[model samples]
Target: MTEYGYFLASEDYGPNALVEQAQMAEQAGFTSLWISDHYHPWNDVQGHSPFVWSVIGALSRATTLHVETAVTCPTVRIHPAVIAQAAATSGILLGGRFRLGVGSGEALNEHIFGDAWPRTAVRHEMLEEAVEIIRRLMTGDEVSHQGRHYTVENARLYDVPDEPVPIDVAGAGPAATELAARIGDGFITMSPDREAVDRFRHSGGGRQQGQASAHGGMKVCYDTDRDAAVRAVHQRWPNMFLPGELGQLLPTPRHFEQAAQLVTEQQVADSPIPCGDDEEEHIRSARAYVDAGFDVVLINQIGPDMRGFFDFYRTKVLPRLAR
Candidate 1:
């Protein structure tokens, strides 16, 4: 059975709003939650970026839903040792219902410290070392390491969870997917690409040792009026359509906004992302992920109608998917 989850976009909503959305998601029959971990929103129009760790703490108290950072960049912006501590605390707070989803990350968040962004290969190297450090620290044993990317000395987590936190790695291409297969407790990707899933499975990432298999996600806008939804998506999430490495290389929200101006409302309207109250459209959007062999499907709403989105899924979409 595929689990359906709500993706709480930290880039789109503030901490309080995210907590409320988590509550609403649980009531709406969603079984899990995926919250973004970002230091900046993609563009100013989306207009919000709260510290994801703080919000996760609040969520632990507010909702019973299992939570994971849709993906946090442990390679840069923050040291992986610190992220391990944070994830460890989060796991304790959530009573073992937490997953630490991590990735190579974008310059938009990681570049704030003025560290030169690494190339894709180097970033993967750093992430692999970081994941090793995190796992070592999570064992509640003292760790000291000297590596090509990071060095740690006399580091240990005092408040580790009874079971080590599961680490789900996010990937968008072959190199990253292979790394995820080699190191991850699970795999996460935004697209419903069967090839990526196949790559993970064949490249030694199959369900062999209790791996979570593939987890997928997509963004949709729900509104009674289709045109209004298109306009809203163009206004708020045009960054979604910015092609290629622009998304990974953009340094600031302003840069993202400047680039997003090129995306037209029509592009959003024509894309596969569902943007209206049409139940069939929404169902198909989610079904695509399920059909691609994803064990978990996470949905993120692109506009302000979160209440409407949850309600529509609760009363209409969820029932159909359940069948």
Candidate 2:
């Protein structure tokens, strides 16, 4: 069955605010939560980046909804062994309703240690190795790996969950998608691209036990005033409209701000993200993912009116989607 969830943007919200939003999402009928893991916001306007693991710990106590790191870059910025420990602790904290979503990583988060940013092929390789290390550690046994990208010595997680924590790999392109198929327990992508989902399922994915989940995430603005919503998105999330590898190549929020200046309000207005309180539009946007074979659709509100967004989804959008 397709389930709808709330996506919590760490770049745009503080930890407490995100937890409150999670509680409200549960009250509003959202069955799961997707939280972004980041070291910096895309721009100063989107200004906040709380450590995601800390927020997950708080979320474990705050809500019963399933929680996932919309995508964490386990390949860099942190070693995979440490990530395994974090994931294990998080799984126990969330009472097993936790999934570690990993990706190849962007320079914005991974380049902080003055390391040379790797090319796409190398990043994917590193990500595959990282996932392997994480899975091995989560087995509650000693792991000593000396791979090309990372090295771990005598590392083992003492507090693994009763069941191994699932790692869902994120993919935005063909090569990454295939890697996700081979290495991921589930798949994560930010679009309603049916072809990508098919590629994942047909290319060795969904063969373990049963069909693995295909999770799709998107951003929307829910407001009474359509123009106002567009302007808000233009101001806060212009980075959303950035093209090609720019999102992955940029090293800092300042660079993102500079690049985002090229994005105009008209671009955001024309993008697929549903804005305003048009119930049918929001319903249609989410339904696109379901039609594309997503098992879960995670939606993030890009504006300030989260409570209003929750109320709107609770009363109209979700019920209609349910039908």
Candidate 3:
């Protein structure tokens, strides 16, 4: 059976709200949690970005939900050595329930360091090196490297878990999927692109697992007024509508601003983001992820009515899939 999970909007909500959401998700019987790691919320309109690592620590104490960084960029903003230590500590704090989901990050987050944002090839090279360093450190090994991209001298992690934490690599293209297959313990992605999944497997990333996120289908708007739900989503998550390279490269807040210029409330209302009162549409959207061969599917509730989302998913969506 495929496992169903929910994503914590670490960028959209405050820390307290995130903790509350995790508790609610656990009570609602979610199998896992995917938390986004962003330094900024992309746009002022989208709202918050409160240090993802701190949020993860709190979530570990607050809920029994299995947690993973939906995808953290360990390449530029933070050195891989720091990432190693953080992941090791988080692994211990979460009692071995944490999965490190990593990817080659965007300039929005990494460029904050005032370093030139290298092209995709260079970023991937850095990611490759970073993953190697992180893996070695996770083993509690004394690592000293002088690679072209990164260097670590006598670096070691003392607080690593008894078992090594699994690392999931997020990829959108064939080259990245292949890289994941070659270096990552598992693969993480957003679309239902089986072709990419196959490429990942073919490239040698078959051991751990495959996970994906579906954006539009998970929104649960239980208001008696369905339009109210849609409007809330438009105001809160307009960035979801942006297209082209900018959508993929820009940070959350910037993306939101650019998208707002193009996508009106009406477009979001008509799209797949689940604004209607029907529970079946939500189930259909969630099922689409399962049909796409994802071992794990993370549904993101885009609006404010999270309680309604949880209640509706528990009563209506989960049962249908459990059968």
* Model 1: pairs clashing at backbone N, Cα or C within 3 Å: none
Displacement of the residue 117 alpha carbon in candidate 1, Å: 0.6
**Which residue pairs come into collision in candidate 3?**
41-253, 42-252, 42-253, 42-254, 43-253, 181-205
Of 2 and 3, which scores higher on TM-score?
2
Candidate 2 off by > 4 Å = 207-212
Q: Report the Cα lDDT for residue 316, model 1.
A: 100
With candidate 3 superimposed using the best TM-score fit, by how many Å does residue 5's alpha carbon deviate from the native? Answer: 1.2
Clashes of each: 0, 0, 6
Q: What digit string (tens of lDDT, one per residue) describes model 3 on residues 197-299?
A: 7787777666643333221124444554678878877777776676655644675466557657777878877876667558777777667767766677777
Which is better, 1 or 3, measured by lDDT?
Answer: 1
lDDT of model 3, residue 93: 92
Give the backbone clash total of model 1: 0
lDDT of 1 by residue, 1-323 (tens): 88899999999889999999999999999999999999999988778999999999999999999999989999889999999999999999999999999999999999997899999999999999999999999999999999999999999899999999999899999999999999998899999899999999888886635646789988899999999999998998898899998989989999998998789988998999898899999999899988889999999988788889999999999999999
Per-residue lDDT over 50-129 for candidate 2, one digit per residue giving the tens place of the 0 to 100 score: 99999999999999999999789988799888899999999999887999999988999999989999999999999999
Residue 212 of model 2 has an lDDT of 43
Error of 3 at 286 (Å): 0.9
Evaluate residue 169 in candidate 2 and report its C-alpha lDDT on the 0 to 100 scale. Answer: 91
